[model samples]
Target: MNSDAPRPSPRAIASLLVLSCIVGLNTVDRNMLGLLLPQIQQEIHISDMMLGVLMGPAFMIVYSVCSLPIAWLADRTSRRGIIVCGLTFWSLVTAATGFAQNLVQLLAARIGLGMGEASNMAPASALIGDTFGGRYRVLAMAVFAAGGPVAIMICYPIIGRITAEQGWRAAYAFMGLAGLGVATLTLLIVRESRVDPAHGKAGTPVATQAASGIWRATRQVAGTPGFALLCLASVMVSVNFGAMLAWLPSFMVRLRGLDTATTGALLGTYKGLVGVAGSIAGGLIVTGLMRFDQRWLAWAPMLFCLGIIPAELMLLFADAPSWWHIGLAADTLLMSAITPCLFALLLSLLDSGLRATGVALYLLIFNLVGQSIGPLAVGMINDQLSAAWGTAALRSSLLIAPLSAAAGAALLLALAARLDTSQAAPG
Candidate 1:
């Protein structure tokens, strides 16, 4: 992927906005399952472990596994085409989720959704890097990345209402149909463009690396400085994110005695609205820090991870409204730093030609191990302790998320230390 057009052009800005919207749609479609878990549970009668299985392995297994090949294809082919096809396919799968009659059908639908979404982030993230280089790239990526929280802010309340009034199935159908429109818009608006190969940061040598077989590309990506440590950090941080997002509504409903509407409103304000703020702030903070030292890319996220550990713990255990609000706001803001920082560090580090593959591998480990383990661990804890302590069992179970977040912070510190002595892995 290469580009010659001025990065600040109106057309480029519009394209980025459109692409970001598409990414947000992807988030809403994927996480809608977690959002409506209570409604789904009422209809399907799933155990906590089974819920974990559905949220964790059943979806993420295919999501993480299939992304590698899709990313390889994206690296070599047309990214916009792949994104269009994927969004369309996943939207259909999301709608298909409404037709699920039992847990088996739901599982099948979720797997299909995963397979479709596997094609999403890598290509898009890589495309953004291609479009906007250097400091601007991080900010652009931050905007794109905010699609997650923005989607929640924009869609969660509506979806919650739909679930409360029309049922979870209706919410599923609504989101799926909405995604089809978004896909069509993306197909119309976003164009595939390439610039001189010389424009790439790593240039001709790296281009050859992408053309080589997958194994060599894998090694090249894996060998990039701080790449392994970044992956480790992502894996750890995603554990907390995965559990928190997946269980948030459940947690609110079961422990705080909130209904779906109330929970959605609360989350939309805190996790979604505050989260959107955090994303932009992360980009701005890192971009400014990079003026002094690129190592700040690693350092900033380490600090965020440390901040999130205690905030998440407070979110889980604090009984006072003030502490809960402070914790939730702080966690959303601090945790928001991780994705942009990680992706910015990753895209900056990798040669342009193989970005999708590198990102895919990073996501594979992050999701397959970290995200899977978090929700599963929490659900297992819930099942084991629910009888003894009831809904409060989840409060205890959620403690693991912060500890895992701490582990992520430790890895980021290691990455920063490595960057201290090395000249690589930076803007």
Candidate 2:
């Protein structure tokens, strides 16, 4: 934070809370299909490969394509306005999912949901950068990151019961209604910053460069230290995220013979509680440790990625429910803890004006390529092996989860080594 900048005010804290809620809500909509997948598959006869597509490309294609343009608009406009509109639009689209009679309708609704969500993340991240600074900035990002876990913890059990009893459509209806309420709350509570990003504010990029167009901003963001390494590592880590988010609940159902309702209830408590704690812990750890070796920002994630591989394997093959449960909890803790570091590291590297566009670019590739491959490839693997192995095919397919962690660890190692040359601490 610049010494001249005003302290983060009460309203600033309030805005962070609102944005964090939006993050949680966005996560719920994205992961909703995952929890509802088994039911949908039984009713609609979607193959495993199609489940992968619906989870990955069907949603991400639109999200990745739209994010940069919408983020460009956000950087130069009222971020609060865009957020309000996105919330309403996506909430409505989410409600419409309940009405889909076929795969085509569901796909269309997913695409619309993606389009609406594309508007929020980049802009909301930029708002966090604008509203909070220094140590608080990293802490704010942690709060934002925890939103997903918090949402799942609170929502999964209810959604599970709704899906099991009232049907999947009812679960979608409940999520959409809850989202609409949050959107209204956002309009009432959050305030946009007075300093305009476009007018060369104190903490923003140079005006001449800004006037040079998006290409210049692109070049600047691309040139950020560790930007390439961060983007590459982001892709690798996201592979694990996509695979787990899309399939983990289904895996529990298939392997343990737990119903969706029961599975959701267990995972909700397990992943959600541990996840929230880990997210906060990572921020605190990074903030405290970076006061010594600023490279702790890079080091923390690299170590966590390596740790996740073994945990994932234990989760996959171990027969004792208690045994594998430890793996599940460990992977969730390590993965959740590391996620906030990415946001902190990247946000620390970019200028305030460039934050939205830059993060959008990073996320575009992370979701477009890595997330797309994780589910679709795993599903294809499962399909090819299903005849010979039966439910065992899913275990074979999910090895991608651990393999991805190894790959991510390698990429993050390169990032940490590269960061060895820089002396700056991430915010």
Candidate 1 per-residue lDDT over residues 271-296, each given as its tens digit: 67888899999999988877777888
Model 2: worst 10 consecutive residues (lDDT sum): 194-203
Q: Write down the RMSD of all candidates, one decimal each.
A: 2.6, 2.1
lDDT of 2 by residue, 1-427 (tens): 2324456788888888889889888998988898988888888888899889999999998999899888878878889999999999999999999988888998999899999999888999888877766667778889889988888899999999998789999999999999999999999999877333444465555833562467777777787788988999989899998998889988988887899999888888877898999899998998787767767888889999999999999999999989899999999999998888998888778776788888888889889998899999889999999999998889989999889889888888888888752434533
lDDT of each: 0.83, 0.85
C-alpha positional error of residue 425 in candidate 2 after TM-score superposition, expressed in Å: 2.9
Model 2 accuracy (lDDT, Cα) = 0.85
